[model samples]
Target chain A: MNIPADLKYTKKHEWARVEGDLVYVGITEYAQNSLGDIVFVELPSVGDIITSGEAFGVVESVKAASDIYSSLSGIVKEVNNELIDHPERINQNPYDSWMMAIEPSKASELEVLLDASAYEKLCLEEA
Target chain B: MKKTPLYQAHYDMGGKIIDFGGWALPVQYSGVLDEHNHVRNKAGLFDVSHMGEIMVRGTEASLYIQRLITNDISQIKDNQIVYTPMCYCDGGVVDDLLVYKFNDKKYLLVVNAANTEKDYLWMQENLKEEAEIQNISDEFAQIAIQGPKSETILQKLTRCQLEKLSFYSFQNNVNLDGIKALVSRTGYTGEDGFEIYVSPTEALELWRKLLEAGKKEEIVPAGLGARDILRFEAGLPLYGQEISQDISPLEARLGSFVKFDKGEFNGKEALLKQREQGVVRKLVGIEMIHRGIPRYNYRVQFNNKDIGFITTGNHSPALGKDIGLALIAREYAQIGNKIEVIIREKKSEAIIIQLPFLQKKYKK
Candidate 1:
């Protein structure tokens, strides 16, 4: 529900914060709330090439396991190793606890992502 | 999806609802870990009305039921509950249920909700004796109060001397919150607990009354998630996961429930043959030595060869370790056998240990 004005969102409930060539990506607050008490987070390794809309990792809670998809095609530059130990941090602050940093193939892909208001509207519609 | 009698109560308590076998049930109320720990330490309440209750009554009901189930029902006295597996002719489990004997002329069978219709049809098809079987699942609602403080909380409502109630026994026509009910000293969680069965109309009232009585004990409302975890930690066999139509009770380490010495049962011949010849696959406990949570249906391997698959696995809140139950080849079922669980296309090291990842704290 907390959609920061600075970040772009995807339909799969992922948020991307663009900082020059690198885009820090994590799941949205809606995704974290849907998945209660995350016990394990499998993140993509650094230097791994990921495709747009493809599953790159998994997020397992007490109830079920869900696939975490990549928002855009990119090479993973940094992985959040801290999440492996404290996956519940995402439930505490999903926007601040970024999962991975990726160097996108093209900066123009950002245009396709939804803005804060559009993303909030999409969440409302889905709910 | 079907809703239980306590559905509104669950929603009012902020339960996270999910579809479980076509039933709209709560997966968690407070949280899975919190609810599970509360049951282990203090007390917790569960809405188990989704379970099916069948009443069989006739002059030959005892004989018919004894012939239908695997456990020795004749040994049980009146008002005693016996856990057993009803199997097909091939020694494969049809379903696991609890038989509550009222007398030779009457009895009650509690079955899994998802398998109720199938079991009813099977029982009808295999009916060789004269008895009346009625599906009374809709008429009743069941709630389980589990933990060390369960008696302390539930005793405040019922006038029956709960201290005199032994395990696996029940007292009918007990006054619970001014309503006539059947209270049993049995539960799925390996803890001192009571399972109260009441009419659907009085279910919500009894649930609210219990919550109020146990407020000082910090008894929280639990859901299917905590129930599943607690049963797993207790090493209780679930029907679809541990024993299914294709899986025999002997393979599930439930041979004790299948009494070969007692006369003939439905799957007695096949089970006798299986006991004579060894079973090929066996269920065993596995603990992750590597860093990964083994999930259901995950392939288990040794030396790169697939030997089995995980039935149930989770990050145990009590043990603080990743544990699972796997049905593997008999050769790999030994204690301390090294294996690997293929978790998300990655093999994680695991070792076969003794079952019941956590020690049971039941009151005998």
Candidate 2:
């Protein structure tokens, strides 16, 4: 349950790292843990427009499949190609292995997500 | 949620708990794939205490069971086990279970955990006057030692000569680490293994002892998650998935387990008619040719029409690809038949293949 102080999280277990115009999006450790042994990742194509709290892709685990949601409204700028061959990388290093890079239409939308501490508390309550 | 006698041991070994059929049980320890591979190559022990055990006894025990199940119990010899389905009057399956014949006057039935209580009541109501049925699920614990190295590891702790035991056969009252146990050369996984039945009090000690004794073989404690994946790879039909109260065994492709030639069994007439006419739907194996993985309840399409739905699916740890079992129209179950699985409103191409997706190697 490593919640890096600099990152923001959503109730859906997605994390966003605010980096000026580009924000890195990936699932959190807690999300990957609950999903169990990720096998395949379907990433949104670059240039695809996504809305906050909407499903943009799917993560298939050995036990079940789950939808990955967009944390903020954005246009996908890049999708991680490494996940195509090695989806377990997301399980190994969820925070560092970003699923996609998006250029937000409104970067201020990130403020609606919870901070690291609040997100950690939410995760505890979920458990 | 019900906890088995070995619940604390599972938790202490880093098992991840989940609610399975109203029972609080471990779904995995390390990971599903890792545990699956361990059982395939090395050895793995499973706490199957949640499985139901029932005893049927009396002078008419054999007659009572023959009228209660779809399979012929008369063919079962002493110390032998038969895999079959218990069906409702309407030809739908109640549950699939293993019947072990102890003698002419007594028989043992191992049923699915989720259907234990229901099955017991069903049997009690339908039982004839001469026979009595008892539920003994709580009185015992079952441990399955599965994989290629299982025999050698288990041989070190048991007095019985495991080499003489044939597949689907059992020996009673054998000493396992000074405790009497019933060891059966049968398992759900597609591997050579033994299933041991012991008193609940000896379960934790037996598990610990086996884990320690099996160190060289790298035997691990597997959970339900791994068990599901392994059985799927073997093409074994699960209760709720492949067959259920609303689904008949004929449609589940388990017709071999139903002996129609044996006269006057439960649901015999319905099955006989079904056999002559054939079922409209049948369970089949699907291999994903596209990127998306198919999951349970996903729609199956053929010839631009919805034909069926997926019963179970996952990336097989052994095969390393997306595979699934689905119930489809009998016309679409042919090998190399092309079909589509609907995933999140999009269609993914799939092909019907012969099961099992992986080959099995049961102990002789």
Candidate 3:
């Protein structure tokens, strides 16, 4: 699993890149690999709000559908409309394919997110 | 979880194992969509050893089968197979299985893996003095080579005149290189293929050998995930979803398989009454008009009223669209009827289309 050291991740397999008060979020490589051949990705609207640890959308594969959770509480600033037509892009390159951009409501919550090392350890333990 | 005889082979192939109805089995190998397309264009081998097998023998075997299943087993000759549904007294499906007749006094039943014990017990309860039933699942293993290229690929393994074997027919003890096995021209995938049954001991060897023999044909090892999608696109009935304890053959749109003219059988009285009165619900196909995909057990609405629920839904790799099977009120079961599928609390647009999603390429 490729966990970019520069970004932050969550135990739920979501990753966030912090830039000022704006955070670009997407499912991690581990999440995309676990979900093979992603057929559809349902994402929240551009201005929708999502609380930390709450399910904001779904990512469906050939086998089953799974909920994608938000890492930090925020109002969505941008939604990756590209995923609606080409969800397989996430499987091809998860880290680069950000799903949403959020304006953090609780900016301090980003600190609570797991670092790459911690997230990798959590994935190993779960596996 | 229970393990099939070929479990180790699946592990070695880097299969993604999942607990399927208490059995530890591979849900995918390369991937579901990849394997699915492989089976459609080339060929794919599947380890179906987890499926249950039961032997029925004695002079009353033929007589007993007439009362046990909805299809007429007598229509099939020796070395032939018949697909049928076993039902409860209330006309609900107990299970759907393939019955292979070796002779008038002997038969083999291939049932769903999870329903083995329950089906065996049900058989015993209905068994007669001369008829006997035995759960021989652990004693045997099964594998299928399915796709358009399956016949040519499998022909290289066995000297049997496979070209002479018609669909739904089997030959017992055909030597595949050296392994003594029963090869049948039957499969779940809508493709011209063969299902091979052999002793559990030879399972892994046979699996490896078949994969090796079909290497040139691009036959990949498929798992439950791809198999499910293949069968779904073929318009086959799944036990729990399409038909179950509360769903009858009629409601499931498998009424043609129920042979009321063949004489009394399990669920005959109730089914006959149901036939006379007409089914209140009917199973139909749905194609999404909205962006979202519908899923299993999702609510279906007609005129904003909860009319039914989706049995199974998936993105058809072939058709490149979202399709599903739904059992709903008969009044709303007509083709071209528009409906709403509740996907994550939001209503999505869908329309009833002709079943099967696409033309089946079975015989070719």
On TM-score, the candidate that comes out on top is: 3
User: Which portions of model 1 miss their true places by more than 4 Å?
Assistant: none
lDDT of 3 by residue, B143-250 (tens): 999999998988888899898999999999999989999999999888889999999999899999989999999999999999888888888989999999999999
- lDDT per residue for candidate 1 within A9-41, as digits (tens), equals 999999999887899999999998888778889
- List candidate 3 segments past 4 Å from native: none
TM-score of each: 0.97, 0.97, 0.98
Q: Report the Cα lDDT for residue B176, model 3.
A: 92
Clashing pairs in 2: none
Clashing pairs in 1: none
Q: Comparing chain B with the reference, what is the TM-score for each candidate?
A: 0.99, 0.98, 0.98
Lowest summed lDDT across 10 adjacent residues in model 1 chain B is found at B355-364
State the lDDT at B207 in candidate 1.
Answer: 94
Candidate 3 TM-score versus the reference: 0.98
lDDT of 1 by residue, B193-240 (tens): 999999999999999999999999999999999999899989999999
State which candidate, 1 or 3, has the greater TM-score.
3
Q: What is the C-alpha lDDT of each candidate?
A: 0.91, 0.90, 0.91
